[model samples]
Target: MTGKLGIGIITYNRKDILQTTISSIFRHTKTPFEFVVADDGSSDGTPDLLKQLNVPHVTGRNKGISWNRNRVLWYLKEEKGCDWILILEDDCFPSTFGWELPWIEALERYGHVNYMPEITIEIDNDITSGSGTAEDPFIAPMHQAFCVGYHAKALSYVGYLDVRFEKYGEEHVEHTQRFLRAGYGGLSQYLSPERGQLFYLRGGLDTLPSHSHGNPEIAQRNQAIHNSIRHEPLYRHPWRTDEQMFEFREEIATALTRPPVEPPSDPQLFNSIISLGGDGIVNRAIKDNFHWAGLGLFDQFLVPFHTLTAFLQHNFAGLLSTTCLYGYHDALRCRDTLTIYHNCLDKPAHVHASVEMFHEQLPALQYRFRSMIQEMDELCHKTQRVLFIRSWRDGLYYKGQHRPDHSATPDFRALTDAIAARYPELDFRIMFVNFGNAYVDDPRMIFANTRTPDDSTAEEELAGWKDLFSKHRITLLQNR
Candidate 1:
């Protein structure tokens, strides 16, 4: 009770109802705590409503309920450093005075608790016959997820909502089950009607906009996924694949400690080097593999890997779009020459093995090959030069010649050419550097085919790569 409590209202496309919910919570709830309405990319004036209400909140692209809930958990618990968190759906509004105390108390006593509806059930007489106050609340084993509360201890053990539950349905069920399996007291009816205190009620005063329509197919699919994983150990966070999970965890760990690497200020213009390739460029810089001998090339990167990865992790829905490679950045922050680099390795082996696989899952690959077109056009007034590296061959991995003609990604040549023609002063150039082995042979783009270090050691090869990059930087400077 001494520690701070954070309340989060998960909402999507329900501006009017959310407004009512916020107003109701303010009026009824007596707990002294800061709150946030975690907006799941609401377009129906929800952001405007949050602004008008002056409520602190976070917004991201409309990933499903699970991801939205995870956002709240991450922000309130991890970022805001709250000791206790109470999460409620947009429709669930407080019905009782000092409704927050019991929830917070429940989180303290029982690691987790859920809001039970007023519907009567065959309750255990022994447990139901308690005082039912903040210290002793009427309890039940049944789990209802419309409203839920957790202490930091519970969250650390329970992890997060299973993201595999795409839309709705079984996500909360799976979460509660996981919590129970972790040797903790799971969901309980803290606001039992038998105790004469109803904590909260669902739905707003007026008709609300619906975003998550009940898809029978999705429900069935989610149910199946849930059933399959029911007997398994505590569910992992975020990703399904081990590789992806490890990759995400490592990236998150890096983001936690790594501050945004700032670029040296250009007095006249804002220049940034963005990597369209995955972590390759960042890894090079971090390991001191890249040559920054005298050029200070490392300081020119405005959008480093850690920064971009953190943004993408939060706004994951952007990954589904084939056009948007990068996350949202302030347009004011970017100007002048914007160099974007992408290698063939940007497309992961298992994900983008073929055009069929690439289209099906739409795996979260690094490069959105056509994003530069939009960037170039948008920054035309400020941008004077565009050095777009479509392909760069390193000796680390074998290059695959999956051209734009064969895949869903657009032709970089056609896109850049159009951009160049539209803005003659843009000085757009696409370079394909095939240093180790030449896999892609495209005439429209500039190709730098250099000798492969076939017999060199790892250290020697790394040094060679550093020198190669230095030469490229020299060329880039001359072009500028």
Candidate 2:
């Protein structure tokens, strides 16, 4: 626990974002640690940029995500002897300065610190102040590997990530269950009250290969995930004190004995990413987690997000949108009533709201529909491809020769990439079906030659979607 912390980034192709991630780490993290990048054969300028930054990096020959992560662990843990390594995707960055101290401190107390949080946290100078528990800190319980810090001692027992998980998908959850089996727990039970802990960053990894949703390979990929958690051998911690060992064992027993909760089938994508532990330790730790799961991907994102924007617009007038996430669950738990002081200079100013007033204003959520326009509730459950509906030469959503690289707007990349960074298993493709004239050369967003019968009516919009679904054989679920 007293050893150095190494921030490990798994990256490919994105040069600019990687640099920003590195710069943010140096700027925001007050802790002394090694900055290492594990590159999966980036022909981009990333390797050169790393060299310029004077950071040590390992070059990979197109090995998949799982292998790269394990290799990074081997290099950092076996060769460098760091006590802990925080695995961050290349697109992630620290939202504030010295934000890692609390994370490191949490690792000291807990065996693991899983960071799949969507709500942005801002940590002030005090690293000890937190609301999470050693078992269930921040009262937020989400299972999956978005970004996580692991103690070397814990890694020794759990071993490297299962390398068979070639792309980002379920490896983290599989790895997490194994870690639990190895007698480790997340920092849910040890959050401090003194430190400010809001951090945010865009993800840097792709989720899935293009248009690979409902592909048989996904089911096969998930089998490996099942194997990782099924019966992985457990090992006693070499460094844990007797008291820690007892608590760890208790958590494992809870996980094993409790019933597992099955993820919903709507997103079909959720089935791949969410492992069902029937009311197991994870299910029981925090009740809000079920509420979270019910949020069901992107559509669920709208509610809390809209409220935050509305609050920001009304109270903190200047800021319209932010990478920062407000206390989302708190607002809901308070029955739509949220209170953030607009005039606080350094910290959150205290305030209260009436349930009636908050509800009266909450209905305005419908006006901000542009963000969700043409957006699906979920992208065909692990769909890495986007089959856009546009006219061939109509000048609607696209303009010019229809090629992906010519697409000038890979705007979908940011949307899908953000989700992919958090879920790495979801490889996405943004395809623009050229009902209009637009070029699509970017493999990430390919152009297809499909068009709707008419663009002038909602009937046409419905027909267009139906045609696309029929062509791809996709089933659309009702949006919540």
Candidate 3:
């Protein structure tokens, strides 16, 4: 491929979509552009498929998306000696016009121009379209397809993509920012009114919650990756000679090391405390309500709260203890009072009301709840375990106009069983709360009811929970 324009596409797990994307690329572009498929250690037969294609591709060690793309770009520059690179996603396919003479003409008219494609989202009956341009108030469609035409001299000016952004979301924006900072301008073009269609796939958002599986090894690996990134100094001025870049990096390291600014002491106005208990309700409440104490609690509940807590403990030491304490809960609600006092200097903070879950059939919600629990656990190990719960009770009954289903109760039972089996280590010390009349007298007080069953299903659910708790040697706390 003599007159080569390197096209790099990074993919993981989604081989079917990737294959479709590549086929579309070949169909559109007969222009001599060397296709570079950067596979991020996909276990889904993608490597075999790529091998069959017989195109030049690079397989990265089971790293992340950013690293894979960076590696491919490096190969294109250093080995392939390609002039221009067009970056595309596995989910995006170009139209027939994409490879036509118009594209080349546009490039020639606007030399060294960065072109962002217009993206269309196909909903049931309607399509939403947006030109991937960053306007004043809103960000560009960062994930849409884009073309970067590299002039010979511009190659020395524009550097590689920052691999620190391992995932898909912010890397593109960061690259655009760097380009703009380097005095380069880009444009966004709507190819046609119906240029590219984004088929809404499942789990499209990167922030969707996932299960932990309680594997310490995975947790350890994640921690190691995090630590390595934190310790590794990012040298942005890569165009500088190696010695100059190293020197600049050392200066940054030194600047990062010097830090000591003490705030004026206030003896009269003591630190305030707020404790929360429940699941998503508590998590949301704590985040929305608390913002004063250095904006720490808000970030703490972001994701994997436990990991955040541990990070704070290691870095900030007695900052949390010296400040305030907020307790959030879902399972154990007994220590709501004691947990507030012991950790918060025997002074109780505001006890945010717990949430009463009425829907009993949703097992998928349990996955989100488990993720939150893991975050809390990581935070607890970091701090003095300030947020405590003695017991928690939840059950489903007819609420509003909705009727209760017998089938729905099984899902809740399964959730309780899974929780019991998974966290057996904390069984004795942690209280497993239940929303059942057999466990507590006033079911109506805990949860509002609009209708009742012929038989009390709450009693049956409580008995099942008790059996599991006993089998796991975990303490069962029932809040009256």
Candidate 4:
């Protein structure tokens, strides 16, 4: 309680509400605290209002609730050096003077506490203990996240909000569950009798003037992410690596700022094309066609395989299920490919899986496949149409060099056919970026290549691809 207290309000496109909430905080809260607002790309005069109020705030593109909250955490905890932090949504307004005292006390005792707004407060079966008295408020599962307090120590332990939760809904639940599992306390609350008695809630799904940030599709996606990681272990290691944090911060900065593109004449055309473990040909196509085309996981990476069946079953496993290499414990390498983690490591880390190792990791491969397919199923919900580009080659690495033995054209065909069958409703078009055997006579397959021997220029090859895709009623975007 003696250390610095920082209060951060997260607001998005709700200027009037945000101003009112700030006014309420000043009028009702007597506690001295450092205040900041995290603005989620508000284009609706909210930035001007914050400036007018002379409020210290962090403003960036609308990266969603979880990301906005992360900005708050980074600002208050890391930058401002606050020992205690409270995060509030713009719609949650304090009702009484000294309302923060109880929260501060509870945070001191339990390391964390979730505020329960009067309008939405309800007794639930999940209550672990406590009554409505000030001595011991009703303790229950942390369902809502409009307002929450955290001691700096607890904040450090829990880490920043998972930006993967996207816009809204289940992010709070996942964060709270993570905190609870780590053995933190104080999900206790007591509502006041009068309007704005404790905190007035005016947002979320059913409330009047409800939250303007999230849509049903986003809510469903957030729910799926939460459910998938519901049983995952709590953090001892940081929630995200330093490199990942840099990437996420960059994402926040560039959110929704991609160069504009004219919509394809056909609505069924894809907005983005991602590489699915192929060579650099698809990468070249993506870069040449779209002004804002960015790199994906498989771009510029080689996934060498002996057969289609093995590649189809274990490709994702090789990328994700990696382990430290022997004699080079500092380097992690894939079991099925020549991918080594931390390219900065100055160590010998070439990992080509032996036949014995492949057989032994069958269970790991199956588990990774199941997890991968679930993610693939979620892709259908992302866009109306998506084109996946790949190039199949039968090869293996011998002492760290790629040796092409044969063409895996048949295997690529089988893999593409199986996936097309599995997700018949999804427009999952696969483009083979190789020649000779790339021209597969299949409805779901696309054959595009830099025509060899004919000395076809990159532009000529790309034009050929566009014409072919157009014939198949698929529009390929050109440089804008």
TM-scores of all predicted structures? 0.49, 0.40, 0.35, 0.47
Q: Kindly provide the TM-score of model 4 when superposed on the true structure, using C-alpha atoms.
A: 0.47
Give per-model CA RMSD. Answer: 18.0, 26.3, 23.8, 18.4
Residue 322 lDDT in candidate 3 = 15
lDDT string for model 4 (21-74, tens) is 787777767678878888988999997887678877776556688778877777
lDDT of 4 at 231: 61
Q: Give me the runs in candidate 4 sitting further than 4 Å from their true place.
A: 122-129, 132-134, 186-209, 236-244, 247-480
Q: Model 3: per-residue lDDT, tens digit, 286-342?
A: 233333222123222221223223333344232223123343442112221212111
lDDT of 1: 0.52
Clashing pairs for model 1 are none
Error of 2 at 373 (Å): 78
Tell me the tens digit of each residue's lDDT in model 1 across 222-244: 98988787666674576566433
lDDT of prediction 2: 0.46
Which candidate leads the pack in lDDT?
4
Q: Model 1, clash count?
A: 0
Q: Give lDDT per model, in order.
A: 0.52, 0.46, 0.38, 0.57
Ranking by TM-score: 1, 4, 2, 3
